[model samples]
Target: MHLYDGHFGGMHLIWWIIWVILLAWIFFIPADIPYQKTIKDSPLDILKKRYAKGEISKEDYEESKRILNSDN
Candidate 1:
């Protein structure tokens, strides 16, 4: 019935849109938790790193590589 009432209605609609977008953002954004492991490296890749670091012997590296390759 009044201009001020229509303005209030528009404000309420904007508030609802803002809330929906905020909720969608909160639900859709990817979170990288520190404790969760996102396995980006392949098993052989990890084995190669271990061999390079001297954490595993060359013979062990070759044996593990053969086993892993045979799996596929």
Candidate 2:
């Protein structure tokens, strides 16, 4: 057995203790968050709702609906 020198031995022991604590902390932490469901409305549905509410003209509504449906 080696006698404890003042320099390298104390530093090595301190580093090892720190490393173990860090590893334990990493292993025990929760990985997943709770899921929340949000209501997602499509653009055409929103346009139709606005049209029904008299927020947009019929021509404008049709134009916007056409634009929303056309992918290319």
Candidate 3:
């Protein structure tokens, strides 16, 4: 047995730093890029989102939905 029987040593601090950097990369990488669009939203998806956000009424939504569905 050596001296200094404590919990955290040099490697523990390094691991903590690695974990913090990994978490930061996971959380912020996608949002950090302003112009990089990962998922391309379709016209139907846009219409759905607009309807969900109250930008279009139900009647108009149904009419546009029918038009969009018939084209495909």
Model 1, 1-72: lDDT tens digits are: 686856677887899999999998889988887889776999999999999999999899999999999999
How many clashes show up per model? 0, 0, 0
TM-score of each: 0.47, 0.48, 0.52
State in Å the error of residue 65, model 2: 0.6
- Runs of candidate 3 with Cα error greater than 4 angstroms are 1-37
Question: Which candidate's lDDT is highest?
Answer: 1
lDDT tens digits by residue: candidate 3, 1-72? 644566447778899999999999989786646777578899999999999999999999999999999999
Candidate 2 structure quality by residue, lDDT tens digits, 8-59? 6788889999999999888987565558565788888899999999999999
Collision pairs in model 3: none
Per-model lDDT: 0.92, 0.86, 0.90
